[model samples]
Target: MREEFGSGAAGGAAAGAGERGPVVVALSGGADSLALAAAAAYVGERDGFAAAAVVVDHGLQAGSDRVAERAASQARGLGLEPVLVRRVAVRESSEAGGPEAAARDARYAALARAAREIGAAVILTAHTRDDQAEQVLLGIARGSGARSLSGVPPRRELGDGLVVLRPFVRADPSITRAVTEAACREAGLDAWRDPQNADPAFARARVRASVLPLLERELGPGVAAALARTADLAREDAEAFDAMVAEQIEEIVEHAEAGIAVSVAALAANPAALRHRIIRRVAEAEFGRELSREHTLAIAALVTHWRGQGPVEVPGITVSRAGGRIEFARRTGSPRRRRGCADGDRAEGGGARGVAGTPEAMEE
Candidate 1:
């Protein structure tokens, strides 16, 4: 593993000689993170790159600061230079997602800040294969799209030129935990265990404690690996779809008065899946909104089943068909204009794709 890291970091440095900066590890006082810190430090030394560790204390539980300090101590002992412990405030949210999401967002922001201060270009996280499986399961439960099922991305831009890398996403958590604990024991360090991990109140904790174990027992021991593999395949498929969308989107879309307009005939000519994707893309690109599956399908109906239906009202925008085009305009208080198809109004050029008359409507 050390040789692999050394070769990897060497290749990275060889790409841009002067751009090599310190490698920053996110240490959470847990076994996974500790192992990551140790590996990063060893690799940095072997490859002539600087290594640092940042311990983000979310202050969500009692004695969190102490845990951060202990983690920092272990990082320094592992020969990681410039060990840092950053304290972050987690705001409580009553929104759909729980406090875990809020804390994770805050923690990543803090880690990015630390990286900027330390002149680091990369931040490494300790998310393992088990974590990927859990994310896949959660996305499945939520009925999210393929992108959501893709699970934790292996790499992503963290803004300000920093990149977040999850190197352990392919490694099993049990292996990482065992390796980390053995490393700590050899170095005479004690890793702190978070008590919240056992609390059933948290959905993730319940999944970890009950759901994964039961599945492994009933369905054999390979279920987690299978889920992780599914995430990888989904990510590749989603990336291909994104590339396709980017290549063809501009041809059928144009800027409208207050929003964007797409060609109805052009959208209808494509397959239903691509048409739905294009509609969602337009909503996101023009209005900075992610349309729900229902809203997307409703808008698609204006293209496929133009039954003189009124405008479909989605959050922050309205969709209507007129002038052989589907217009997505911003919602306003004043009355707006809409065009509907009369009975027996046939589509123009293509088969069944036109709204003959104009029907004016407004969303207040």
Candidate 2:
């Protein structure tokens, strides 16, 4: 697990902190996070860095505050200093992706606030191999692309100077949730189990309780490990493609009058895969909208199969082929509009693909 922190921003933050700054752990009173807190306490003392714990109460369930306090007390018992409990309101109905997403967003926001207030060097999360495998399965069910299938990232920049590290998820052999439970038991910590994790109404709980077990039972063992491995490979491929896009985007994309334009010739020169990525990237970066597969392919046609088509209107952007360039501008008035071209002008014969970095991509 220590080797997992040896590279990346995790190592840099730890080394830079010396003895002045602390490493904060997000403890949920669950086995996974509790084990992480235990490990951090030992590692922080051994390496001469301060360790702290934060427990976020979403206020969705009864007795949530008590649960948060219990977790914070356990952290203190483990010798973590400055244990804190944060309460956040989660507006589940108003959030676009439903309750689970709302809770996650609120939780992270609280954690980030705690880290910033403490001037912490790094924040640790307890996502394990099982979580990674579940994410991949969820992505598959959504018919998502490589980025979604890549699963949760091990290290993510949470803006400011804060970084969130998931040492368990990135462990070389991959740490399982069971291992965390065992660790808590050995350390004599009474871990709290969240009821939502076992609730059938939640998609993740369904996947964890049924889908994964059935696959393992029928196909034999190691299915979860295989899925996690698939996420690793897919992430590598997605990162490479992202780098390629970044390298060429400056040369091919430029700002237009009221929107952005991509050189149609350059787009047509690249393969279909790269072309779709560039198109999606343009929409996301410029307009803050995610292009669905149908919309993406429709825009791709403006460059590859141009036949004097007018403009193609997606959910929030209007795409057109004009003067040897593909132009994307904000859509006004009615959300659906078509000019000159027939409804069948869209590029055809492709399955649904989720745009990377969008909520739809990371459904779980």
Name the candidate that leads on lDDT: 2
TM-score of each: 0.83, 0.89
Q: Residue-wise lDDT of candidate 2 within 1-364, one digit each (tens)?
A: 3334333212333553565479899999999999888877776776778888999999999999999999999999999888999999888653245666677888889999998888796888888899999999988977768998999887788887788888777775557888788878888999999998899887788899999999999999999999999999999999999999988798999999979999988999999989999999999999987777778888998887888867777756778888988999897655442444344323221123212333434443
Model 2 lowest lDDT segment of ten:
347-356
lDDT of 1 by residue, 243-347 (tens): 878766868888778678889889999987688888888888878866666678889999999999877766567789987899999875523433542322111
After superposition, candidate 1 runs with Cα above 4 Å error: 1-18, 94-96, 170-188, 332-364
lDDT of 1: 0.73
Query: For each candidate, how many residue pairs have backbone atoms clashing (under 3 Å)?
Result: 4, 0
Error of 1 at 351 (Å): 36
Candidate 2 ranges with C-alpha deviation above 4 Å: 1-20, 93-95, 336-364
Task: Please give the lDDT score for candidate 2.
Answer: 0.80
Candidate lDDT values, in order: 0.73, 0.80
TM-score of 1: 0.83
Residue 144's lDDT within candidate 2 is: 68
